[model samples]
Target: MKLTTSALTPDRWSGEVLALGVFAGDDVPSGLSWPRGADAPLRDAVARLLAHGSFSGARDELVAGPGLPGRCERLVLFGLGRAQQVTPHTARRAGAAVARTLTSGPNRRVAVALPSWRVPGPDGGGPGGPGLDLVEHLAEGLSLAVHCGRWNVLPDRFRADYGSDLPQEPESVELLGAADTGRMLSRAEAFTHAVVLARELVAAPANLITPQRLAEEAVGLATPGSRLSVEVWDEAECRKQRLTGFCAAAAGGADPARLIRLHYRPAAPVGPPVAVIGLGLTYDDRGVLRSGGAVQGAKKFMAGAGAVLGAATALAAVGGRSEVQLLIPAVAKAAGPGALRVGDLVTTASGATVELNHEDAHGRLMLADALHLAARLGAHRTVGVSALGLPVAAALGPKAAGLWSTDDGLAADLTAAGYQAGELLWRLPLVDEYDDELLAPFANLRAAGPPSGDGATAAAFLRRFAPPGAWAHLEITEPAWSPRIDGYYNAGATGYGTGTLARWLCTR
Candidate 1:
């Protein structure tokens, strides 16, 4: 949908209907007073009347009554209890509630007088006053509510029977404030587009999203003026470079091996650039090397690769940023004559040696080369976003992701932004204690090893490839795909980090 804002004027701005936001106890500002227009449609106040309406605020309705204004068919009064506790998230819910409620009726447009937020800086007003850019915040809220449904997948029968009956179709928002409504809407649109792209990229079948396909996808990101350079290295190049660590890990996959790299440059050169590395294991059948034959088990490994592709799409869509170099080690883990086995040693691009500890722990091995490549590319702060393990989900639950980063500031920023975007992460320590688990007598790092709830071990393995003092960000596996029905997100790749990375770049 579209969103725009206008001055709270009654003269040139009188419309058929206008929706205003009010806190539980705040007075209606007189600036929005109307002068009884000739063909005014109605005036409405949306209020949270249900006792526990906060959680399911949108599930409530717009109660039309007699206590209204001239030609005022309805009033929408939203609840903001203990106003001091209201945050951006609250604003989002309030916006979603209003939008969802309005869409059910004949209202085609809405003018929201966003509730003012406390300003932390002098850019606008004062603290606890009409502060934080409500326009942007509201737009983000609307975008989330609208696009959250696209990732959701329901039983075909259930959807075919009742999908059209659902009321939560996407909503378009219009800003009624002085802030740059056009730009805010455009950014929101881009964010939504990025989310859609990530979801689609992840939702693709594993066979369709193989290593070569991933490289082709990266090349597609190198459009004119995008400032991105893309390249793909085949198995031959990997073999010569002794990427045994990565190749050994990919030995069981049926797809051809590929190392996909993307380079992004900003118009105005900044300080040392940041690099994002992802584990692009297109498909992992757990290898016939192991006896278990589960199609879903493959998704566990594919999720990591999907995370990388999603991150790339988001980075590409959010174009204006500092220089970035991304390396994705794309390969499938399939059993074959050439597939490396356990106890084998491999050397990384950084010249570090690793032992094939376990064939399934392939994400870390591929990241070895990616991390080395990032360091060689002069990455000041390196961040790797991956679906590393299920232990992360066990630890952080479905809502929040587990994060391990070397840079405290970056970690804090990422965690805070994740919370804001609703797809959040909790800061995890890369304990120096676990550093020895990655070591092997002969290899730089080993592939086969013990499995523990400590998903950060993957990040610990990747640290071997990082240059000293380089910050690293690792997202232990948080199943981006939901096996069951979620309110807005269906049973597919949720595009979990797309918003997080996009917000990081925008604010950075």
Candidate 2:
């Protein structure tokens, strides 16, 4: 959706739908000041609803009606709970409610009047201060909620199949606020646009987004005079590069594999480049003779690749000084026919031997090769991306992803980035003892060792390939996607880490 900042009030804004926040009280929210008739539509809607005894404005309470009919079309009332308890997260949810409500029908345009999220505090300024952050994140929530990431659209029968509840996204969004941050809001929309791209890539059918397709898509990122540079190492080059672990994981797939590398170069060279390696498993079919490998959901295995690519895309759009390279092991983890066996031991370009235990844990092997390649590319700082629900996602549930890092500073930075982007991440340990979990009798390590510390052992395995400096392994998972659209993220691929990745890399 096209997003823009405007000073227009809900009363004057002529749009298909208008959304306004209502605090849980009889009095109007004191945050936003307006002249006479500025908030007439909102006030009138609330007054009418109050008369009907259905507008108590409790937290999360939503009231929608044909307020002002033709001129405004519809007005949605969102409860903001208590004013003192309002926060960024609350604002985001409120925005999402607006998006979901607006997109459920035939509305093609929306205007939102968000109350100032600033809470007066004793320190003279609000905790989050007065700026465009509230509006920015609110806009992001809306953009994500109303976005359509589907590659296949049965246009005429869309409603018949998916129902009108699922949205194709409104054509435009108007965020009515006094803050004159048109440029900043535009950048926010650009960032959201990239995130939506990641969601689209992840949500697409696996057959359509094969390793070859992902490679071509990376190449497409390079435009004339753009700072982004793309390179693809085909299966042969991967063999030449001695990426044994990647080769093993990619074995049974008849489709060719690719190690897609993208570099965002700056005019002036800085310190060592930061590298992000994503497990681009386009599809997964496993042979779990070792532990009864029951692999399912092969389609969205490429979620991590979509995230890092989305981050790179957003960073490229909003120019950054630091050099960043994204390494994607664009290959399918095919099952049956020559799939890596349970007892198979593999070596990587880094010469680290890893015993393949669980076929589902094959992702770590690919990440190892990519990390080694990143070191060769002069990246001392590296990040390996994993989709949500790798190992024991139940530990963190749907709210936060797991973060494992060799450096405290990088871990702190990444955690902070996740929080700043409203994507929660809890740091997992990289304990010295966990390193022993992967000590294999046959090889230098095992992709997975004891179940004692499953997540940390995976990170320890990745630590083997990390060059010096700071190395972090991000284990992320998205919320469940539901056929019944629940908020912006239903029961499907949540381009979960794209925003956090962009926030972390762009700021650095």
Candidate 3:
């Protein structure tokens, strides 16, 4: 969908649908600023419609009615909750609600008039009124919702199974009161493309997206003349670099492992380069082969790698002063002849030996080498995103990802970034007590701990490879791939970490 901003007032806008957002207890048409005599008739019509309909301006509430005689074909009023509590997230949800309500209809053009929010400045006090940030987020939600279901069907699916009717995506979306200074639209487009790319990569079937394919995708991100540059490390390079853990985890698959490194060097440097490592198990069937459990959604095991690539794409598109490096140890953890057996001891590049007690705990093995490489490469800080453990999902539920960080400053920054990006992150303690669970009989560490305290133990295991007080880990499971439609996300890959990483990199 094409998204643009306009200075046109809601009443003067000629479109198939006009969406007006009002905060709770301020449902009157005059709550929104309008020209002197422009919206009188539209206000009267809305007032009559409000009187007859039970359209309280509660959160997510929406009501529609016929438009004025010769103006828009439909007038949509959506609730924005409370004025004081309005935020970028609120704007995003409101945008999604409007898009979902109109996209399934015959409307081809739509206008959205949401209230402006007075966001607090960095120091917590300043005249930071509604501007590019709000407009960008609003556009992100609308575009995401419109394209959420576009890749639900596979290429080889039968035409009958794909269905003939699809939602009618709008041709154009106009932010009724905002201005297009060019940056707003570009930034929003960048974010939308990033999230959509991440979602598509994660949603693809395992047969279509292998480890080699993932490396190719990373290479594709670094187009000619782009700020990003990519390098792929094959098995020989991995062996030369002593990436034993990465190679061992990838040994089971017929396709060789690829260590994808995407570097983004800005025009001017800000701070030291920060490295983001993502676990890239393209297909995980360890549960099915080891414990006889179903592996229906194992393809989503690569969500973290998808997020990493997506963030790289966005950061490259929206140039920033911060130099960033994205690392993905792409592999597939399928059961085969060369798969790591129980009691197998693997020495990582960090010189730490790990006992493979649990064959399914291979993601951490791949990440161990990547984290060590990041630290060895002089990264100021390192952050790893992965679908690590079930205990984390059980603790944090589906709405949030579990966070464990060695540094308080890094943790706070990441938490703030996640909140701003509409991704919830719950910080968990890096309890040193759980370190004992990772001790191996012969090796320096064990792959998995006992069933209890597994989440903390998993984080503790990874901390060994990274530098002290310079690393953070996000253990994401269900949030990466939603089982049902939630907010603007459809029932598939949610592209959880892309926005968080992008926001963090840009702000840093």
Candidate 4:
């Protein structure tokens, strides 16, 4: 999309919608007033709201102008919710509200009055300090909201029955101020491009995004200047290596599976390498092979795999000269007689055995193998993306992802990035007491007990295989699968960790 910055005069721009950012009290910019035609209607609305003396200005509203002279069909005014407390998150909501409203109208062009924000700490001053940083974040959220999957074709009957009209593609966006619109657009475009690739990769027909397809996707990333490699192990090869845990999980599904090892070596390696493992279950239909409703807990099942692709996408976008390895154990944890049973015992790639405490816990098994592979590849830090469960949702709510790690330093970096990106993450401890229950007679890892909180217990399970001196990260599952729509993200896959991983890669 084309993005331009100029001394924006609302009347000069004729689009279906125009968005304004309003702050509490007198914080709203006086120089940012709309055109005379746009002003009358807004003034009337403001007067009415003013009538309600209790209105302290913390909410925004969209208004239709009944075809005013130079005003667009609608104007979206966003409330900064107390200028003193106005944050990057408020900017995100403002941007998203603008995009969503514009999408509803036929107007292909839109302009936004960028939200004002406090600059970085001492590194950057407050008000006068890099005020446009919020604009960058707003643009990012808006772009992510408009992203659609090219490959999620509904079944014929479902499409005919429930398909709703979606918004038209926006042709251009206009931002006020002499700020660096070019830089903001560049970053937004790059992020959207990665999201498009990720959505397409995840939305690929289950068959096309299978173990083999995952291998191809990784190989494709390694074409010319990029250093990428894919090591594929078929069923026979997996058996030879005794990746019984992974195999047992895959055995339940009808599709053949493979353990995909993807390596990305930077142009010139810097510090210790970082490794990421993604759970690649192309299609997550739980009832694939099971009998009377055995596969009930597969809701949002494909999210773990999708998060993995997102990690790779983030790595590819922030393509710096740093070494990173990504591993994905692509499989569908379908239940069939051949599948690993709840009480079955299996061995991990680390030579540590694990009893199949829960078949649905298969994501951890693949991660275990991938982590082992990462250590073998000599990675100094590691992280895995998987959807844990609703229990963690109970802890952090839908907007936040649980961040469990062994290293406080890495967690600190990621948590800071999460706040900057308007993504929520809370660091939970990896307690040794939780790992006691996982010990099995023949297995190196086992479910200690019913998960206290999915995020904590799942991270605990992963810690069983974590190598010393390595940092391991677990993404709370709900936020990743959250269907909540903010300004730009419509109610499907949020692509949550892309920004976190990107920031990590870019800054670190």
Candidate 5:
């Protein structure tokens, strides 16, 4: 969107709705040191709402206020609790809250004002407020807030402006703070576009975004002028390479499996060669079980794929120098006689026999093959993304992802990246003991097992496929999407791991 800056004023502003930021320690000063309390309109407004007392900003706390008769067409006053604690993430969250609250209303245009955050300097230099970085975060939030649906253009969502069902949201966002915000606007727009691309991938429906179509997308991304080179291993190629684990998971589906790889070779590759493998399950029906409840978000089974793609696109856009191998083992889990059943045995490319005890756990199976492929290709560092365990979501809550890593350096690198991207990650253990749970009596490893440390068990299974100390597994169950809006997210198919991986790679 067209992003700019504006200073909050009681008169002569552009927008149907205006959002003013109120800080927790904010108050209308009686001592007229600033330009208020004597004859200012802002002071009058504050005096009118003195009894409400809810506008005191505490972190993660918000309070709404009504617009004045002449001041605001519609105004929302949000909290920026304890100025000292405010970060880019919390600021983005505030922006998200405004977007969620406004989209439901008839208001077509909205603007969010950023409150000056207290950045205390060392050696008694006094607390300084926000600058360009703050504006970037605000714009990032507005961009993410408007993201709600998939790749399709639905005619049913027509707006009155176009006299059609589809109308772009938050037509404009003026990050009302500083005057010269040109650099901030540029940074925010680029960041927002990358994140939204990932969101669209996650939101795409399973029927439309099948394995074949996903492969086509990777091919499409590899344009003549682009630095990325795309390759697809069709069913035959997968068989030739002995990717049996991936094939076993795709046996029942009418749509065949694809081992899609996007290699990004910069002119001068820098840092360690990194490989990111994502689970691209078009529709996860879970073997022969046909219960409706079983496949609720099976379409979103491709969340990890979206994240890796998003990261790749972002890195490309920024001209990053990392030699990255992006891989997605795409498949659809269909329930039928031909599908992989319990007690079936398959051998992977690494010469490890896999026992299919729990036939529905295709994420670990496909990721196993992809990780082995990355290692075989000589990836110095490897990262895998998937929403493998529902129990991880339960154990870790729906706020942060559960991370299991074989290396401290990789874990720390990814964790710092998540922080930079405003995504949260909690490091969970890939316990040595959990490795025993995956061992199969009849084969090298059982495909699936019980619920005790199931998240770790899944990671442990994939760890076998990758070289030690070079791999990190992110069980990204929480950041996928929920039914309603949460912090920095509007609803439906959040582009979670996209930012983390992208930021991590770029910074490295």
Candidate 6:
């Protein structure tokens, strides 16, 4: 949808739908300003709607009505809850609610008058000073929600007649009384495009999105004259580089393994390049012996790769001085004659020998090689994103990802970026006590640790390969894919880390 800013007040705005965001309690929010003697009819309509005592202005609550509004066909009043409790996430949810309510109708235009609340402080106590703009977050939510509505319209192999009757989203959206609308909308569009690309990559079937296909998509992101450059390493090149761990993990797959690298360099450099590595298991099938419904979700094994590539796409469009390197080790794990068996010893690029005890634990192997390569490439800081362990998902649930970092400053920066991007992150300790769980009798490390505190142990294992400067690990499983449409998330891949990574890169 096209997004634009309007100088017109609510009374002068004419559209198919005019959405007004109201805060809790009787008083109107201070963010909504009016010119002298203007917006009286709109104010009266809001006051009358509130006076009826039917709407309490609770979060996500909606009350719509017709008539008594100038030139507008419909009026939508969405609740923003308490003023003090509002944040960028609040605006995002409010925007999603408005889009979901009005998109199914014949309305082709919408005007939103939502308050641009301040972000939380460093301590997350309350609204700190002005940092990120709420209008950008609102646009992100609206665009994402509208794009999600059309996700069902994609061609499906199993159901040829699927999503034939789905309604289209509005053609244009105007942000009333918004500042810097063009720049904010441009950034929002970049983020939306990246996130939608990530979702599509994760939602595709394994047969269609193999390692080669993923490499092709990465190459496609680097258009001529762009700041991004793409490179891919084939099986021979990977072996030459001592990427034995990745090669072992992708041993038996029909598709060849690929090491995809994307580099984004600005016109002028600022600091050392930050490296971001993502796990690229296109399809993970535990092993030949494993069976059940668990493998059905194997298609999402590459969610981390999708997120990093998406971030690369966004960063390429939104120019930044910080040089960024994105790495994805695209490989597939399946039941085949060349598959690594239990008790097999695999040597990683870091010269660490690992005892492969579990077939499903191969992601850590690929990540280990990637992390070592990043450090070898002289990156000042490195961040690895993956759905590596279930213990993290069990601890944080679906709303937040687990963060483990060796550098406190990097951790703080990531937390702030995640907050600004509307993605929640909970810091988990990288306890040294769990290091014993990864110890092997004959090898330097064991593939799988004990079930208890496995998340911490897994982080500890990856920490061995972390760069000496600064490094972080983001375990994003539950937050990357959802089973239902909750808030701004659709029923599939949520593209969770793309926004956070993009925000972090640009801000840095």
Best model per TM-score: 3
For model 6, where is the 10-residue window of minimal lDDT?
29-38
Model 6 stretches with alpha carbons more than 4 Å out: 26-53, 67-70, 115-128, 149-167, 287-296
Give RMSD to native, each candidate: 5.6, 3.8, 3.0, 4.5, 4.3, 3.3
What lDDT does each candidate get?
A: 0.59, 0.71, 0.78, 0.61, 0.70, 0.79
Q: What is the lDDT of candidate 1?
A: 0.59
Sequence-dependent TM-score of model 5: 0.85
Top of the candidates by lDDT: 6
**lDDT sort, best first:** 6, 3, 2, 5, 4, 1
TM-score of each: 0.78, 0.88, 0.92, 0.83, 0.85, 0.91
> Whole-model lDDT, candidate 6?
0.79
TM-score of 2: 0.88
Give a tens-digit lDDT track for model 1, residues 1-508. Answer: 5566665532234333354555544433321222223123322222222222332212222222222344233345444333444555555555555554443444444455534433332333356655444455556555555554444321211123334333344343345544545665666666656655566555665777778877887788688877788878898888876676676666756888898878777788677787777676666666322326634445444554555555555556556468877778887766777677666667666777767666556677787777777777788887777765536666677767777777788788777666555576787778877777766777656653358824656767766677556575657345476665343344556667766776776566
* Per-residue alpha-carbon lDDT of candidate 6 for residues 358-455, written as tens digits (9 for 90 to 100): 65767888999999989888899899998764567667887899999999999999998898788898999987888888889999989778877778
* Candidate 6 residue 357 C-alpha distance from true site, Å: 1.7
Error of 3 at 71 (Å): 1.7
- Ordering by TM-score: 3, 6, 2, 5, 4, 1
Give Cα distance to truth, residue 103, candidate 2, Å.
4.7
In model 4, the clashing pairs are 96-487, 145-488, 145-489, 353-443, 353-444, 437-448
Clashing pairs in 3: none
Candidate 1 regions exceeding 4 Å error are 8-83, 93-111, 117-131, 148-162, 165-172, 240-242, 287-297, 300-321, 483-491
